[model samples]
Target: MEQQIDSLFNWLDETTSIIEQEENTPYIEALIAASNLLFEQQVPEDLEPNYRTQLTNQVNAIQFSDFEREARQKAMQLAILKGMKGATQQHHYITPETIGVFIGYLITKFVGGQNSYRLFDPASGSGNLLLTILNQQQNMEVDSYGSEVDPTLIRLAFNNTNLQEREIEYFHQDSLKPILLEPVDVIASDLPVGYYPDDDTASSYELKAEEGHSFAHHLFIEQSIKYTKEAGYLFFVVPSFLFESEQKDQLQSYLKEHVHIVGVLELPKSMFQNEKFSRSILILQKKGPQTRDPRKVMLAQLPSFKDVEATNNVITQIDQWFKNDR
Candidate 1:
C-alpha cells in the first residue's frame, strides 16, 4: 500500500535521524538501503517474509546483508536449486522476531508448566537462540547459560543480550567442555555447521595461544550428553552427512545406547545452500527420567525466509503434539 510505504519511509527517516545524531551517516545509509530491499517487495502469504536486518558485529560495528531479504527469499524458495551465495552468505543468519516465535512456542508448549527450566546453548552463535528465549519469557525466570569459544562472537552475544535487557549467564568456553553444571531442561544450538568450525580455520587454532582437541564437533556432542540432565532435551543443527557417515557410527551408536533420538528434522539443502556442506536440524532426548513418547518422532523441515510469524506457525504444530491427550 502507498500508505504503508510512507509509514515505512517515515520510520526509516526517524532511524536515520538517530544515526545522523550519532554521526554514523555511512552506516545509516547502508541500513536505509538494506531496509528497502527487505520491504520493497511483497512475499507470498503462505511463505515467511524475509529481510536483511542489521546484525551488530563483535567489535560493536554494523554488518549489512550484501543482498537484501528479497535475495534471501528467492534463494530460499529456489533453495533446492540455487544455494546461498554472496550477500546472504556473509550476513549473520536470523531475524529478531522469527527467533522469538520459534523458541517462544517451544517454551510455552513443552517447558512452560514446570516451576522453571534450566536452559543452555553450547554453541550460541551470536546469541540468536538465547535472545529468543529472553524475548519470549519476560515474566518467568529461568537459569540460563551458554558456551561460545570466540571471544569476539561471545562479546557480541553478551552485549546483544544486555542491549535487549535480557537476563542470561554466558561464558566464553569451548562448546565441548562447557563449564556450566546447572541442570538443564532444554539445550539448543546452531552449532558450527560441520563445514565451518567456530574459527573456520584449523590453522587459526594452531596460530592461537590455546592447545586444542581433535574432532571438536564430536567432542561437543559427546559433552552435550554429559552436561545435560537425564530427562533433558537437545536440539542442534548438524550436517546431514552425519546420519549415514560411518565415521560417526560410534557417535551415533553411543547416542542410541545412552540417549534417544526423538526425531531428525531433514532440512532442505537450501538451509545452507550457500555453504560448502549441506545442513539439517537434529532433536535428541537425553535418556533419563523424563517421560518419553514412543509413538512419535518429531521432524521439521525449516523453510528459507523464515519470518517470525511463519516461525510461530511451527509452534502451533508443536502445541498439538505436546497438548495431545496422553
Candidate 2:
C-alpha cells in the first residue's frame, strides 16, 4: 500500500519540479510538509495508523490515509495557498484565483479563431490576469503584454506569472502611459479603485501620486477603447457606477464612435466588499464591419453585491447571457 500510494502521489513530485523552475514551488513544498504534519498529528498516538487495508499492517505511516483525511489535508493545503496567493504583489490588487478562473473560462471561450494571440492586461498586477488567460488558451501561444507602474510589482508580476516558460513583455510603468504599440484583440483589465498618495505627504523621497476618482470607469474605459482594434474586445471589471450612471449615457456615446457597448455584467458592489464582488466584468467589443449580428447590449447585474451565492448565480447567468442571448 505504501508503494501504491507513492506511485499515485508521485505526480506531486513532477508538479513540484514544474513550479520550482517558475519559482512558484516554495509554497507548494511548504504546503506538502504542512499537509504531512497536520495529517500525521491528527492520528491517535496509541493506535498504529492502519494501511489501506485494515486487515493488514503491510502499509507504512500514511497507510492510515483515508479519503476524508487525504482530502482534508489537500483542502487545508489549498486553503493556505489561496490565502498566501490572495495578496497581489502589485498595487491595487484585486484578482483572486476563483475570479481568475472565471475570467479565464470566458476568454478561452471567446478566442477560438486565431492560432495564437497577444494577451494584454493593462493593469497586470502579479500577473494573475495573464495567468488566467494562459490557462484558458490551452496550448496556444499567449504573447503576454502587461504594464505595472510599481517597480516591485513589475518584478512580482513577472515572477508570479512565470508562464510555461513563454516569452512575455512586462513593463514597469504606469499602465495609463500612452504607447505606440499596435492594437491587440483582447484587452482585459481590473482598474484600481482608490486614490494615490498625495504629493504633500511626500518629503520628495516617495513618488508623488495623483488624486482619486469617484470611479475609474471613465479613465480605463477611454484608454481601452482607444487602444483596442475595431472589433476587438475590451473586458474590464470596474466600479458599479460604470453601469447606468447618468454619465453612462455619455460614456456609451464615446464608445459608439469607437466600439460597441456589447455586454455589461454589473456585479454587486459588495461582491468584493466581503473581499468578494470585485464589481463586475463589463464586456465591451470594439465596433467593426465584421462585428457579430448580436450587437445589442447585454446587462448582467444584481440588485446588490451582498449575497455571494447570488453573485455566483449572476456569473452563471452572465455565461448564459453569452450563450442564450448571443
For each candidate in the order shown, give its overall lDDT on alpha carbons: 0.53, 0.56
Candidate 1 — which residues are off by over 4 angstroms?
Answer: 1-100, 195-214, 268-271, 274-278, 289-293, 300-320, 323-326
lDDT of 1: 0.53
Q: How close is candidate 2 to the true structure, as a TM-score?
A: 0.60
Could you tell me how far off, in angstroms, the CA of residue 240 lies in candidate 2 after the best superposition? 1.4
Q: What's the alpha carbon RMSD for model 2?
A: 11.1
lDDT of 1 at 134: 55
Per-residue C-alpha lDDT of model 1 across residues 128-174, encoded as one tens digit per residue: 66766655665567778887776645655564454344577887876
Candidates in order, TM-scores: namely 0.60, 0.60
In the predicted model 2, the residue pairs found to clash are 268-305, 271-276, 271-277, 272-276, 272-277, 272-278
What digit string (tens of lDDT, one per residue) describes model 2 on residues 126-220?
56666656656777777778877765456545534431233568877755557556778888888775443433322221112223332344655
